[model samples]
Target: MVTERDKELIGALQKGLPLVRRPYAALGERVGMGEQEVLRRLADLRAKGVIRRHGVIVRHHELGYRANAMSVWAIPDERIDDLGEQLAGEPGVTLCYRRRTAPPAWPYNLYCMIHGQDREAVLARRRELAEKYGLDQWAHRVLFSGRRFKQRGAWYRPPQPAPEKAEVRHG
Candidate 1:
């Protein structure tokens, strides 16, 4: 069960951690908590499944990686784990995972993202990975991103206090 303090902590976290040497301490100050206490509470929340995951949302374009391609492949179910592990460990592959096939329309299951300074570089990297992993043997496609979408963390709002009732007297 989440308490009022937990709600406050979640609300503060939704805004993203402050860019500081001691980010947790900053958060602790905001919620009237000690840094160590805040850390322990966050761990408890995670253990109770209140917090599922914590990750970074990178803006590749600002970092000079303007080109992005999502290379998808339809690999044998049994081999996906092995191939995915190999490709994910390679350099230039920023994201890699498996998704359920959409069937007749989309059969691709395994996917990996490659980001580079230009389209040529991204394509070359994809080709190198494909050839090195024998990924070309399977049906695959490289879809270049034409645009980017806003990325941010999840939001959690605090509970609002109830309004006080006005007193009434018979006139």
Candidate 2:
């Protein structure tokens, strides 16, 4: 069960920890906990599978990856997991996952994001991925991003209190 302290930690994390050498320690100070306590709690949460990872999320464009595309493929449903893992292992792939497809219309299920310095390189990498992964047989599309907005970690909100039911007046 989540305790009040966990809620406080989550609430503070929503705003993002300060950018410093010791981010967890800084986060602990913001949440009124010792650095060791913070690390201990985070480790506990990880052991329980509450949080998947603890790391930095960089803005690719700011880091020189000026062009990117969300490459999608319509692979056989049974082979999706296998192919998704393969795509995730590729060098240029930044994000990879499977999505539900709307049949008779939208067909792609496996999706991944590829980043590069320019459009040409991005497209070239997509072509190489198709050839390397034997994805030529499947229908796929590479959608180069026209614009980027809202690139940040998730903003976690505090859970709202459940509303109390009112007693009915017999009169």
Per-residue error (Å), model 1, residue 140: 0.6
Q: Would you list the C-alpha lDDT of every candidate in the order shown?
A: 0.81, 0.78
After superposing candidate 1 on the true structure, give the runs of residues whose Cα lies further than 4 Å from its correct spot.
Answer: 1-4, 43-57, 149-171
Error of 2 at 156 (Å): 1.0
Residues 1-171 of candidate 1: C-alpha lDDT, one tens digit per residue:
988877777767765777899888999998799999889888898899887655565666888999989899999999999999998899999889899899888999999989999999999999999989899899899999875574443334466432222211111
In candidate 2, the residue pairs with backbone N, CA or C atoms under 3 Å apart (3 or more residues apart, or in different chains) clash, namely none
Per-model RMSD to reference: 10.6, 9.3
lDDT tens digits, residue span 1-171, model 2? 667787677667754567899999999987789999888888887888766676665766889999989888899988889878888888998888788899868899888889999999999998998888788699988888886674444344556332222211111
RMSD of 1: 10.6
Candidate 1 has a TM-score of: 0.78
What is the alpha-carbon lDDT of model 2 when measured against the actual structure? 0.78
The TM-scores, one per candidate, come to: 0.78, 0.81
Clashes of each: 0, 0
